[model samples]
Target: MDDTEPVRAEDGCRLWTDDTGHGKPLILCHGGPGLWDMFGAVATVLSARMRVIRWDQRGCGRSERREAEDRELAVLQWSADFADPATARGYAEQLADPWFGINYECNAAITAEERQVWRETELVTACRGLAVPTLIVDGAQDIRPRWAVDSLQEALPSATRVVLPHAGHVPWLEAPDEFRTAVVNFLCPA
Candidate 1:
């Protein structure tokens, strides 16, 4: 946080929750389906304005790492990339399977066969059913040529998308003030 030190969670989840001002229940899902123990200063600022709920999506940081297969099923983890938002896209395509030719920002080295089967995964379905007033934030620069943020917004109708320019991968980390402003706007939305 920009003001205070890191606050650890005791639920075996490496999440930091605080009732900043009793506003909307804002659950901050950082980017990177693989990152857990990181947050940008922007959250620290937003912490003052609303009830901020941020968590490590279960693989990165303190969350116990899962089997490679199970990890692949963790679609919620993708939202953790707030710390490393990107403007470009297509990370999964290049490294993706030749069949579907799916490229992702974070593509773990798997056999070509694995890539083919991975495309049929129901991970997105699980992610789609998440019951939360979620806000998907992304960096202006993503590895995939076409940013997943738009697709994410369309898929998750309840979720809104926010893109920060001059910020890649992690908006809060790259441009603290701008990220903070966005967070405030999303939280306040006046």
Candidate 2:
């Protein structure tokens, strides 16, 4: 059974969410300052044995689309991150659509808060104490630096890191088979 609904946030934003299947609950979060849940296929397969829930971030996807106060900053950041001219051009074309509806304010605020947390928290130290097994799947071509992820993997005793080649920010979109294999191997190691 599939159930889609609007989950109202504490800030009064209605986030779009879809819940399906029925066993162990698994919440799949999309990664992005301006992206929606694109795990329909993944969810469908997992739903056979586990409950899968997917939600769009506030001001993204089917959720509320709030106006961004500064589009130039977002554009500049996007361009700077995708340093490769061809990649930047492709991203620029994608962002040209009104449907992108990026929430620059939300992105900025979240980034600021993340920076503050990184400054104040000893994440590496905390990871050292975590006994849980962690699988860090990273896209080789992700704009974000890989050093941070490398550091986390170094810190965690049972952490396994898999970098998918030819995949950018979203590995599943570009390397679905490899991504699936990595995750399945991690979850059902033989």
Worst ten in a row by lDDT for model 2: 67-76
- For model 2, what is the alpha-carbon lDDT of residue 32? 81
Candidates in order have lDDT scores of 0.54, 0.77
| Decoy 2 TM-score against native | 0.47
Q: Write the per-residue lDDT of candidate 1 for residues 1-190, one digit (tens) a residue.
A: 2222334546443333333434666766768656663554656677677756665656555455434424344322333333342512333222222334224433555556567665533646756787676777677764444445666666564786777765655566566687788788878989
* lDDT minimum window of 10 residues, candidate 1: 87-96
Candidate 2 C-alpha RMSD relative to the actual structure = 21.0
Candidate 2, residues 1-190, lDDT tens digits: the string is: 6899788888777889999999889999998877899999999899999999999987678998654513543554555434354566456445554545566599999999988887524877788899999999887777887887788789999999899877766566456699999999999999
Error of 2 at 102 (Å): 1.9
Clashes of each: 37, 0
Leading candidate by TM-score: 2
Estimated TM-score for each candidate: 0.35, 0.47
